[model samples]
Structure formats: C-alpha cells, structure tokens
Target chain A: MSRAYNFCAGPATLPEQVLLQARDEMLDWRGTGMSVMEMSHRSDEFVEIAETAEQDVRDLAGISDDYAVLFMQGGASSQFATVPLNLLGNSASADYVNTGIWSEKAIAEARRYGDVNVVASSAGCGFTTVPDQTGWKTRADAAYLHYTPNETIGGLEFDFVPDSGKVPLVADMSSSMLSCPVDVSKFGLIYAGAQKNIGPSGLVVVIVRKDLLGKAHVKIPTMMNYQVMADNASMFNTPATYSWYLTGLVFKWLKDQGGVSAIGELNARKAKKLYHFIDTNPLYSNPIDPRFRSRMNVPFILADEALNSAFLKGADERQLLNLKGHRSVGGMRASIYNAMPEAGVDALIFYMAEFAKERG
Target chain B: MSRAYNFCAGPATLPEQVLLQARDEMLDWRGTGMSVMEMSHRSDEFVEIAETAEQDVRDLAGISDDYAVLFMQGGASSQFATVPLNLLGNSASADYVNTGIWSEKAIAEARRYGDVNVVASSAGCGFTTVPDQTGWKTRADAAYLHYTPNETIGGLEFDFVPDSGKVPLVADMSSSMLSCPVDVSKFGLIYAGAQKNIGPSGLVVVIVRKDLLGKAHVKIPTMMNYQVMADNASMFNTPATYSWYLTGLVFKWLKDQGGVSAIGELNARKAKKLYHFIDTNPLYSNPIDPRFRSRMNVPFILADEALNSAFLKGADERQLLNLKGHRSVGGMRASIYNAMPEAGVDALIFYMAEFAKERG
Candidate 1:
C-alpha cells in the first residue's frame, strides 16, 4: 500500500521525504556502517548528529545562547512533573491557566509537588474556548505560569501568550509547536513532544532559559533535573538516538522548506481551508471558537450524529486515516500538522463534501 | 562500507535482520498506509504491534502471569529513582550491592528517596570481582534488595542470584538480560535499558511482580508511579511506540533463533572463545576473575598500554569499530550482546590476533 495522509493526533505524520531518507539510511548511516540507533551516544559521529540537530532546531526556532536546547525522553508528560520539580525552587505556589484537558492534567500533576493556583479556567464553557487573560488572577510571586498553548485532545488553542509579570511563562506546545513562528525570548521554558511537529514519540525538545537552571527540588530524579540534562547536553544517559536523529532530519527538511515562516504560511492555509469547508458545509459543525480553534488539530462534528461512522469510513477509504475525534469528545478531528501536505487537506475536504451529499 | 561489528556499550549493536525489517516497513507498516511511528498508540494496528511485542518478550523471558511488564522511557537510569519511589512505601531503607559504576549509580540515586544499605561491596577490589552473597549484611526490613546482575562497563557479573528471602529482589539487567535464561519467579522486579540485548535506546523494559504495585510515595510523579503505568498497560501516556515496535522485532528474532537457552549456549561459546584467546596470548590480558567475567562485555587490556592507539587504528581499518574501552576504564572493551553474531566475534578475534602478531 502507498503512504497515506495520516491524521493521528500524535506519533503523527512525518514528511515523506524524511521517512524516505530514514528508510535508506536504516542499515548504514552516512557510510558509518551503523544505524544512528546503533551508534554510541558519546561517539564523535553521534555527537555531530546530535549537535547538528540541536543547531538546526535552534536556527529554525530562533533560539538564542541565553537558552539551552535539550533533547529529552518520555515526552511532554514527563515534563509535566519536571517543570514543577525544576522551576518551583523555593516558591510555595505556581500559577496555571486551565484551558482544556491538557491544562487540567498539568494542574493536577503540579499539585503533587507544590501549591497549584489555577488562576483561570475554561471549564465553565465546556472547554470550547480559551478564557480571556484579562480575567485571570495571576500571582506575582508564583514560581512559573503554566498553560497549554494547544490542547491536542480538545482542539482548543491559545491565540496569544499570557503575560506572567515576574513569574516565568512555561508552555506545553506538544500539539502545535513549530506549526508557526514562536518567539523564544517570551517564555522561560517551551517544550514539545517530538511525535507531533518534531519526529517520533519518545523524544521531547525543551527550550529553556539559561537562568532557569540548577533550581530543582532535592528529591527530583537526576534525569528530571533540567540542570543535569542541560549540563550533559541531554546525553546524561543514552537518549532516543534514532528519534533524535529523525527529529534532526525534520528540522533540516523544515529549513529546506524555508524555515518556520514558510511552513507557518502553509499550515495556516491548510487550517483555513479545512475550517472554511467545515463552516460553509451545512452537514458539518465544529464547536471550538473560531478565534481559538487549533491550527494543527481541527475537531468537527457531523450535523447528523448517525453519520459519524459513515463519514469516517468514507474518509478511511480515501486514505484519510485517524479522522476519529478523541474518545472524550465523540466526533471527528482532522490533525493536519506541518507534514500534512495541502493536497491531503484538499482530499479530506473532498471526502467530507461527498459524504455530506450522499448521507446528509 | 557494510555493517561493522559495533561493540560500543549501550546503544550497542542490533541484529541486522531487525534493521532490514524496520527499513522495509519505515514508510508503511504491514500495509497500514502509515509508518509505525506515525500511528496513534490507541489505533488497532499500533495496539496489535504493541501487544505482539509484549507477548513475544514475555514468552522469550518466561515471564509468568504474576508479572506486569512495562515499556517505559528514560532508560534504567530513570528506573533507579522509580524503584525506590514506588517500592519504598513504608520501609526506611533498601539493600543494594555496590558492584561497579552502574551499581554505584543506582545506589546513589536510590539513596535520594530512602535510606540505602550497601549490603556488599567489590569497590575495595577496584570492581574486578563480585562480593560473595554469604558475606552480605542484608536487612530483612529493607524495602527491596537491588543488585546489578551484569555490569557493562566493569565487565563483571554475578555468577549466582542472591537470596533476598522475604525481601523482593530487583536486578538491573540492562547489559545481560536474555543472554541466558533465568527464573523470573525469584525476582520482584527486573529492569533493562533496551540498547543491549533489546533494540534501541529511550525504551526500558520493566518486569515487576504484580504484588509490588500501588505502593508509591505520595510525592511520586504520575509517570514514575508503577501502579498507574501497570493499570494502563504501560500506556499511561503515549509510549515510545516506535522503540517498542523495534524491540518487539528483536524479541521475535530471538525466538526465531531458538529461545534463551539456545542463545545462552551460543553466548557461552562466544565468550569462552574470546576469553580463551585473551588469556593465552601474552600481549593481551583481562583482569576480571575468570568465574565472574561478563559474557556480554569482556574488558581486556594490552600488556603495553602504548600500543592502544595502534590496536584501535588497525581494528577500525578492518572495520572492527567501537573497541575502545570506556574513558573511566581505558584499555579495550568488546560488548558482544546477543545481537553480535558469532561471525562478528570470529572477525574481531581474527583481527585481534593479527594485530598482536604484527605489533608484538
């Protein structure tokens, strides 16, 4: 079977070009006679691969020397605990803005370590919209202000970065990172699990300010300590070397496609096309607020609930896989990350139109 | 260049056949129209891949129904802290044997969570031998008794499993798991970083007795909680799916090569052949006690340390790579994990003999 336009929420689609290169180099990488997975993390060759990847991400993201870019394992979920352990040094409380499921998860995990003050929440609205920042009651002495830039499950996204005053701003960009241009200087730390816009599932890229180092709680596991990881250049242990290498390939591919600015334009166009079709077509509806709808994951529902399965079946037949919405919210979600070509979006739109005409 | 005999310790060699299979399936896995890495963890195709891999490992290791196998991230180093965080529920301390660097590191990390009682130590002998179990001063009240079954860097291994009696026994089998068959019923938990006998880094296979679940410290991170992970079938969050899939392929390959018992016989033969050559040759020497020498990692030194560069240079020219010893212990180390075939061993020995004959 030929490759399909995968719409998985995570472990999502990668650029076809990147997958081709990986397949070609699976046996022997760069004439080294070893796959990247087989190479010692400390070897000169792997170090170069690691370093090149770090540099490419840094270049693409416009990260500066003031921040240390770490390639970590266990994804953003691990960082949920790591952020509080590292950033909540002497502070007894931290602020959080609960936008959706991801935000609530972060809030719950943060409560395990220290006081988590949910300065604002969108639960009153059934998580279809982001709460206005003007209504938030953030604390000045809070260690860090945490929020989900994009919630993968709920298809809710923050259209603006919340200002934290003196407190550091930390964003879990797992679903939406690299889909568009992001300013590195605005946040104390920014993290994205590689499965989304990056590469594979096991690796998470953390961009943290240099000053936010060495303040982890005493009981924090060494691996969770951002300081130790940053010091070792994220090679504190054997990393997901293959995942890291693949992520590097993605960063290079993004560069070749004219960096985040160019990809952002393509992403915006893709999201606009799909959302436009959903709104104009009488048979489909999306609950998310138009202003805060995720550009990466667009969740929509069929006008007739009975037609959900048929809509999905037709989409699958046309190679638009994993269009099923998250189980929590029963409908359909089309996750068109940076790797999903515009043609793929066009195909999905075409399928949705045909299904609506025949069934709706 | 064709594949070289990669002997670098962890993130070590993989079976060539496994790499080839992964290459062939990189773009589309089993006609799913998506790479395994791109599949949702909850998707039927990925779930099947995950389940098959889990079942294969269980069969290969002879794990019983009483054990819950967890595919975790952050490697064994993460497990060092996780063991104590979860198991040290009410106990004040855990018993550990300080065999070498790996043991010392585990002990050091375990200490941060609870009192660690070093039951025995081979540090007095520069870690060349394992301390006898009879001399160990283990505490009956200890939360668990932890030991490094095989030390990758020191090239030392325990010839016998220690009798922890009522206390659950934990072993870090990162380097020697599946090299030989072992009775899983005796262990409370067995953890291995999956870069050695298993495939790739960033994935750790944890086999834990079912009774040990649900007893974690209040402050334990959700990701580090054993019960949470077990209850979710190691899908507490999106796991290292691709790594887990590759590891499953390796396990299938192991079964194809006959089970652990057959591999054990082959492993013994390979170790014996390599050690026999090192001991008989006047120019080469291995300091480890013959009985305790690691079958997986054989660290040996040249009689004249000055010939080290020439030895490595000649070996590399012949495509025998990563033979250099760890920087902490600098001579030469050959990590012949299960994936390193007998032919690779023969090639290495042939090159070693030729180098000694010409340079001696």
Candidate 2:
C-alpha cells in the first residue's frame, strides 16, 4: 500500500503500523467474534481495551495516581469550554498566555465561561514568538494559567514550560502532545485532541489533577463535568469505542518505539533537518524565532508569492502532501507529528531543494 | 472475512458490506492518496465526504430544507444536555415523557440546565410500557417536549408520536433512528448517536428545524450550539471524519436495501419471527407489553433460570454473539438491527430451538 507524507494538522497522519493493525482487527478484534466497533462498551473485552489504553497513555506520560485520564469526545475545541466549566471553581478570573491562533481561540471560549485575563500575548508580533514568562501578568486571583505550548497554526511554541507559582497551569496541548515528553505534575489539567499524536478525530484525552475534580460550575453540562467523567473512568456514557481501540493500538506502537522520550529525540531531529534546510535556502523563509519554532508544525513561506500554488502542486506531484498552511495563516506548514517519519522530512527537504533549483 | 452475528445494543452491529468497504478504503480512500482519516477536514475531498454523508442522511429521513442535519460528536448522552442547552430559549420549563431508562437519564440531565416537567413516565411500571399521550401532562409554555422513542435497555418503544400541541416535539432516536421511515416534519428536532443504525460511536446526527437555530442558552458551549453547528454544517470544529465517512457508506447500503421503508418491513418480519418463537415456546417468554415491544431490541427469558449461563455459552459456541441481556434487565436480548440479516435471525432461531430441546 502506497502512503503519502500527510501533514494536515490533524485528523492527520497516524502510524502505518497502527492503521494496518486497525484494518486487520476491524472485522473481529482478537477472535472475539465481533469487531471492536460491534462490541458492547460494557463487555469484558471492551473494558480491557479502554483500561489498557488509558494505562499505556499514563505510562507514556509517567502519570501518577493524583490525576484522572479521561477519554472524551468533541476534540480540544470542546475542552476550551470544558476546562473553564470543570475548573475555575469559584474564581472570577483565569490567566491566559497567548502564543498563537489556538491560544486565541481557547482564550475566546474561556471568556464565555468567566473572566479570562490575557496574562501575556504575542499576537501583535504576528504570533512568531512566545512571550517570555518574566513579562506575564498573571492574576493572583486567577483560577489557572491556560496556554497553548504549541500552536499548530502559527508554527510557534513556547521554549520553556511556564511557571504559574501557586496557580494551576492548564494547557491545550492539541498539537504538541506526545511529540515530546511532558511534565504531568506541572499542570492542573492537560488535554489533547487525539488526531495529532494519539489516535483519531472526535476523541480528546484529558489528564487532570484529581484534586481539580468536583469544582465544575453549578450549571455545567453533565457531559462536561470532569468529576462525573473521572468517577466513571471516562465511561460515563458509551465512549468512541472504535477510536479508543485505535488509540490503544497507537499507545502500544508508541511503547514499542521506546516510548515518548525516544520519539521526542526523533522529532527533534526531524525539526532540526527541516528548519535547517529552510534557514539556509534564500528561496524559502520561516519567520518564527528559532527558539520559538514549533518542532511539530513548521510553517514556511516562499520568497516569491507567484510560486506558492506551484510549490504545493510540485510537492504533491513528488508525493509530499498536506504541506499547505492553514488559511488563517497563508503559507505552507508541515506538521511533523510523532507519526511523521524522518524519511518523510528528508523527502520534503529533497523536494524543497529540487523546487528551488528549478524555479529560483 | 469471517463475520459473526454480533448482537451488541449500540456500538452494535454494522453491515458486513459496510465493514468490508471501510477495510478496503482504510489505507487510501477513493484514490485521494490519503486515508479519509488522514485528510484535513477543510480539504475538498474530505468536505465532500462530510457533505455527501449529510445529504444522504437528509434524503433517508426525507428531511426538507426547513431542517438542518448536524453531524456532531459526544453521542446521544451528550445530546441529552445539548438538546436543552440549545432549545430552552426563553422558556424556563420543558416537558419530558419518561418511557424507560434512557428517558430517566435525559430527564436528569435536562434538569441540570432548566426545569424539566416529566409529563408522563412509565418507570413506575418497571419500565415495561409507554405511558399514553392522553395522560401526558405537557405544559403549554414548555419550550419543547422530549422523549425517547425507543428504550434500548427494556426493549420498549413508543408506538405513536406524542402531540405537543404547538410546543416543539423532540425525540432521542438513538436506538430507533433510520430503523423505519420517519416523518421529519412531525418533530422540531431529532438526534441519534450513530453507533446503532448510522455508523460508529463518536458521531451523532441532529435533525433540527431551521427555526431552532439561534435559541441556545447564552452560555452554551460552542460545540453544542445548534445555530453555530448548523451555520458551519457541523464543521465549526474538526468533526469525527472517519465515523462520518462510515455513516455515509451505511446510508448508501440502507438506500440500496430500498431505503428505510423496505428495511422497516424486513425489521418487522425479523421481530415478528423472533417474537413469535418466544410467544409460542413454553420455555421462553418476553414480559414487555406487546404493543410497546421494540422491533429493534428483543429481550426475553428462558423459563428455567438455572440455564441462563449455559444458554449464553451455547449461543456463543453457535456463533450467535452478544445475546446476553443488558445488566439492568438481565435474562437475554437478541437485538436485530438493520445490519442484522434475516438469516442471522434464522440461525439464532435454530440455536434457540436446539438449546431448548436439549434443556427442556
């Protein structure tokens, strides 16, 4: 089966090994005489699938017993509201550090729930830099510090984890999760939409400190209640079973690849190679600060605007795919998540060189 | 490949044809050079998949332009909260008809958002029947009247639609949707989790009257706001792409089987044959009121209590899978959804006869 280097910034590329296993098991998972899709969520087989997946995720993250890992739906976009709904306790204000488009979106959604203070914002800089922690104006009365460490849209990320002091550090890790190792204890809650490094779309894995539970707003919707989700092990209702199963396969695959630390090193290498190629090439440019360039989603632009569409077409013809940048930020972005192999990045680098020689 | 007669209630059985098609396309869908799972939600190809699925669903339900078909995540359990969050509008109270377990869950969730008036409930009768509409005490000022048309747990169903006067009628059709022809004009809204008759677990299809667009509570989560979802065609966020595509395939299969009407006839025949066997056999019985018995989910009991475990074991050995009843109403259930072929039902009947002869 032929495959392409898909960089669609999610609902994106998954490991081929995971996909093949999923295809093989789509009809009947492990001789259970029923497809994972066809099994009852409450059955022993399904329960094992869910528990094993959660455990492996915990293992990969090195999570402790003080947290609850919830397998939920509606993506991280939903989590923008869910975070404020389930946390915030009685606080009127929450701190937000905006690095790029995703953080802006998260901040807007949080505003609907309560007072969201823009503690630090680099939006004025065209989202090319992460505001230094020293400049952050975090509120003492804030419920938490919410930030997007990696913004999938702007090709920017924070170089260091923020220090929130006594306040909880909550993060929307949709684009960067599992692209590297994360400190579980550093955040009150961390949620990632699974389409990136986890599994598929429609599933979001929320890792929240256990103490943060039961603080949901009085009017919070039942499904958004973290405590309810926690108590039921993310089985408050029937979960996205097939997606969860696929996640289990991915978790297993990650473990086989020597877990997150090993994957992180490989990811770093890919980012270094791709960024190095762009940095030296006068024909292409990545304007983000080198320290702030996202290792996961890399957005670069052509020196000549006339060659933009042609660049994409040529890349597609060379089997380098989904290199188009998000419409919100016009240019090209290659989101090399955990699933994107080094070979794929090498191919992209090769294509860039060939395209530049032919058109420059 | 080697298929089994899977009888799971939801996250339940899908057509063999559908599964095969999904497997074949899992790696690369329609020569797009990317699996449907890998494509961007914004890609022209993925957009077409989402739109075509929605259009075919609209056609299957005979939905008019006045209605908006929304593809969402978080399933029907999420919709229990979403329905009220979006529809409570200016009204402080809503009417609900409680028929079984699902209705009770819906009532409990809606109460968290607004005052829910349970117009009628059959929970007192051990949830084996549906309360008559004449006895329903629906309020004139109720923003909407909500009810479950099919209680998958008790195998009970509402035989007729409730008349809510001018109040918008809403129904949770999770277990009943697309099982038979539906009059889309009869209700202001209908939502169903895709697992049963539609597709996989994470996706939900919401058919709402166009007028229900902007009535969401000001505090409604962005993902749950019907107006936003309709305005964006359920693309306000990245949707459950793979599930949506599978649902599209299922819709095609349903249409090929002569649409819902033809499927309805076949479903009725399957229900009739299985129920007839239970009614005639002294060794088995179904206690639900005949008029209220659901055509999709059939719950029954062996006359000899001691043989329950053995019956399940023997059924599994015979390849009649997932026949065990819901834990809440345990004995046995043989859910025959649209994907369940009549031959599978015949195999089940044959197994039942053989087992009965041996044990009786």
Candidate 3:
C-alpha cells in the first residue's frame, strides 16, 4: 500500500491520486461492466474517454481548433521518423537543433528521409547549454525546424522558444509538455511521449497545425502519417487504449491542480529549490549552465564519483528510487517531472545534503 | 464488483484473474513501491518483467531460440508496413493471401513498402471462405508468403498452414495466437497484437526467425525495423511496458489454465457449440464457410434483421456485452478469446436461443 518517490525519467512518476483512481476503476469503469482497457476504441464510452482526454489537453494548453491533437502510439522514438516522413513533404531538407541525446536521435532518424541542417548544436559544450539562437544557421527552404525542448538525459532545456519566422517550428517536447504552457500557435507540430509528464510509455500526444496535416511523404507508413491519424482521430489502429485512458485521468488530475499555469509555477519552484541546493552544497555539482538547466530532469554528480554506488544504495534504502543516472551519463539524476511533488523534491534535497555531509 | 462478458473482437476480453492481480499491484508492484508503469524500462525490476514476458511467450508457444521474439508497439497496423519493410530485403515482391479485412489491410500497407503480389484473395467469394492453399499462386522468388491465420473481422480462419516451399511463410496471428499451438519452426515470422488473445492494445508481439533479422530496408523507421528491435531485446526505445506486463500476466494465466493445447481444445469446443446451434437454430445463421470459420471471432446474423437491436439490447441486459459485430460486417460478433470463459459462451448461447424463441 506504500508508494515511493519514483524519479525514473520517461515512464516516470505519475500522480498518486491518478494511480488510486485507476486502481479503483480497473475492474469496471463506472457502471460500464468492463475495464476501460476492455472497451472498444470505437465504442461510445471509449470515444468519450479518448475525446475528453484530447479536449482536456486543448483546454489545459489553450490549443486552438487550428491544431489536430493526435493520441499516437510508439512513443517519441516513432515520432523521430514520423516528423520527417510527415513534415518533409517536397522539401529536400529539414532544420534541427541538437541539445542532447534525444535531439541527436531525432537527427539520425530524419537523415533516413531527407537532408538535415543542424542549425544549432550544444555538442561542442558537452550538451551543457543550448546554443544561442542568434548564432544559428537555419535553412531558408527547410520543410520544418525541429528541436527538443527538454533533453531528458542531459538535463538541458531551451530557456526561450526559438522563433523560426514563417518556417514551421516542430518540437519534441517528450519530457516537458504540460510542465508549463506554451503558445500552441507558434509551433507547426508538438509531440510528447506520454511517459514523462503525461501517462505511460506506449502512448504519445501529438499536436500538429491543421495546415501542416497532409504533406506526408508518399512512402510514409500509414500508421506514421499525421494526416491519416488526424482524419481518423488517432484510432488509425486500436490505439493504446489503457494508456490513453490513464492519460485522460492525468489530464483531469492536472485540471484539478489548477491547470498548467499553476503546475508550471510549482514546477519552476521545485526545480529552483533543487538547483539552488546543488549550487550551494560543497559536495554536489551540476555542470549545466544555470540559465538553460531543465525544470523536469535534474542531473548532478557527487563531489566524489567513487561514492556513486553507496550514495545510490543509500537513496534506495530511503525509498527515493531510480536516482541512478542514465548509463550514458555516469552521475545521478532526479527527474522531478509534473507528477514529482515538492515534498519529493524536499526529500531529495534532504538526502543529497545528508549524503554530501557523510561523503564530502 | 460484477464483471460482464465482453466479446469485443480486439481489446476483447481479459482473464478476471489478470485484472485482479493488476489491480492489487497498481500502487506497488512486488514491493517495488511503484507500479510497473512507473518503472524505467532499463531498471532491474522492469527488465525482469520484460524478460519474463518474452520467456513466457516462448515457453507457451514452444518457440525455439532460433526465432528472435520482439515486443513491439503501434499494433498490427504498423506491422502491416513493418513486415514488408523488414522482410522484403532485395526481393521485388512479397506474396500475400487476403482472406478478410485484416489481411487486405496488411496487403495495402505492404504495397507502400514493396510490390505485394496477392497470391490469392477471397473477395470474390465475399470473404466467407479461405482460398484453398492448393490453388494459391504464390511467387517462388518472393521474400515471404504472408497470410492471416484468423481474421477478426470476417470470422474466416485458414484451416491449414499455407506451404510456401522455400518461401518463408508469414502469418498474422493477431486473433489466433495462443488460442492454439502451432509449429513455430514452420514459419519465418508470426505476429499478434496483444489486445485480442494477449492483453491490452498498443503492444504487438513478433516472433521472427533469426535469419529474418538484419534484412530491413534502409528507409525503414528504426522503431519498425525488426532487426533493431531484436538486437536491443525490444528496448530500442522505452516499450509499451505496462501493456507488456499485462500480456505477461495473461500468459501466466494461460499456463495456469494448462497452456495452449488445453486452451485450443476449449476454444474448438466453444466454437463448435456456437456454430452447431447457429446451424440448427431457425433464427440464426453465419455466412462464413463452417469449415473455415474462426474459433476466436464468431460472427452470426439473426434470421430476421429487425430483431438485431432487440437481440443486442436483451443480450446487454443479461450482462453479455460487446456482441455487436464490426460496422463493416454488421450483425453480431461474439469474440470468444482465450479469456472468454465457457460459462460466458453458455450464457450467450442461452440468450440467443431464448431471443430466437421469443421473437422468431
């Protein structure tokens, strides 16, 4: 019956209330006599659940009718190819900004389809900072400009949205969607794998500007076609029904917590507290530039790298689980996404301070 | 909580025991203090879960290590493209047998990736029967010969596996996988969307012979590339972890019910009972050829079409749910998946007979 503070990034922590609600309704949703997972995607009840989840995203983020909200499957990794396959239309090239591992992945996938212009990259700086937009080399005839708003593994984020002028701005916001509100009209497309700020690992929420719908490559896989997905309302296939239902519950839970604006403020405060502690503590160090540090994923290294395992073992004992950093990065990471409470942040800070005092 | 008999074709029905166990583990899975959905894919806990699920599928289906089992996403629709993109290799064409809607859809997606020579089709016969394999005009030079063992929509199932000689035989077992045992060594690949006979939607299990690995078209999306999935043990990206976990639970439940052989006997008996009643009853008829009718999905029509609504309403009243057939093939479809209990089938039969007596 006890729940720990789970800090795993992507398939990350979900609101406890949402889990309890899902648990309560897992056997039979309301009086429907079946679980939401058991309901057909085309059934009136499931359609309502699906539509309500989409509408909630729109309401929470102020998304207009001009954009098509698609509940897609295959996570953000699928969208890596989907973006180029759908957006690259007749254009021979697309513009990309490399922030970290996720952006690099997007670039690699896009290369399979068309020419990619790396307009900006933080690779030179060890993915510690977002390159200044002023020094960028954006393509004039690029199909779309793609960027990762929040790099989950690198603990890097864009402090300001890049203005692409008339060119459409496409963002992979897998780790940051709904942590704050963004002006939906500014982007041609926005996609997030639901595992982090949304729901589970399989479902992804894609918001594409209506005008950008049908420009898919001729050879685009039907399941990967944005236009087809929008036309069919994201039920191009059976959809990840249970994941979508859980996402709806999350959207409802987010609304109950005063929508994105309130949650954003809370997220900002949580990230700031953790970063401020890291900055002041003698035994902990975060390498990212303060201005571009991510509010969702916060990676830090102990003053002594040799003590990493003991530190993590201690964290696990305290039930502050999944503090181990990604294998690519050798330190510890605490991904305090929207579901991660400020209390969890305080607990993390408490553990960090205690670990520092003992190991310093 | 009262549970109804759900006859939904896919996302159809799940074993009650699986749901109960999932509910109990919703908050804290095996004292891990987080739900399986919250666990990182790379974590020891979730990896164990993922591995265990894959192992169970191999055990239940009697698959040898010669086949690389991939837990993938985007459902069977995605696989429609994935199959051709990965398997087509240097071949100019792939041979396909279209028996029903799902087969036709698969053929359609494969056409985008390569030339799909429909070796045979039952469309002229109104998709009521499987085209005899003896008369199939399969290509000798084809990369693979594909067929649907059971079509969820038209209730048509191949009575025997198509012999493609040296051409690797591929089957979409979406609705029939684990409903019976099949000789895994006979086919190059077998795939099934977890929703029907496995678990929830959004997860597709692919069993590809190891030789089929590394043959994906260069343009194939990384997520859709079977080789990449197998190489990474299906963790090329964060998979549909929750769905995979649920599928594992179903596999365990299947084992407890005495494996595929025992369930195959039950499934056959259930289908025979329903088909026999329809044959003898004055008010019911199934258009599909009885010899090739699906054991997984039983589609029947009332002798008087006017009584369809009344029949469904009464069935709903009796806690028999989702009996409505696919919109494309309107009548009634009671999908008796492995999870659909014998008692539920009996209840359905009793209801059908009573309705016929009252209205015929």
The candidates' DockQ values read 0.89, 0.72, 0.79
Q: Where is the poorest 10-residue window by lDDT in model 2 chain A?
A: A1-10
Q: Candidate 3 docking category?
A: medium
lDDT by residue for model 3 (B282-304), tens? 99999988889999999999888
Off by over 4 Å in 3: none
The whole-model lDDT of each prediction reads 0.93, 0.90, 0.93
Question: Considering only N, C-alpha and C atoms within 3 Å, which residue pairs clash in candidate 2?
Answer: none
Whose DockQ is greatest here?
1
What is the clash count for each candidate, in the order shown? 0, 0, 0
Ten consecutive residues with minimal summed lDDT in candidate 3 chain A? A1-10
For residues B234-342, could you state the per-residue lDDT of candidate 2 as single tens digits? Answer: 9899999988999999999999999999999999999999999999888899989999899999999999989999999998887888988888878999889999999
> What is the per-residue lDDT of model 1 for residues B1-360, given as tens digits with 9 covering 90 to 100?
999988888899899999999999999998889999999999999899899998998999899999999999979999999999999989889999999999999999998988999999999999999888889999889999999999999999998988999999999999999999999999999999999999999999999999999899999989989899999989989999999999999999999999899999999999999999999999999999999999999999999999999999988898889999999999999999999999989999998898889997
Model 2 scores a TM of 0.99
List of chain B TM-scores, one per candidate: 0.99, 0.99, 0.99
Cα distance off (Å), candidate 3, residue B249 = 0.2
Give the residue spans of candidate 2 off by over 4 A. Answer: none
Give me the displacement of residue B176 in model 2, in angstroms: 0.8
Q: Report the CA-based lDDT of candidate 2 relative to the real structure.
A: 0.90
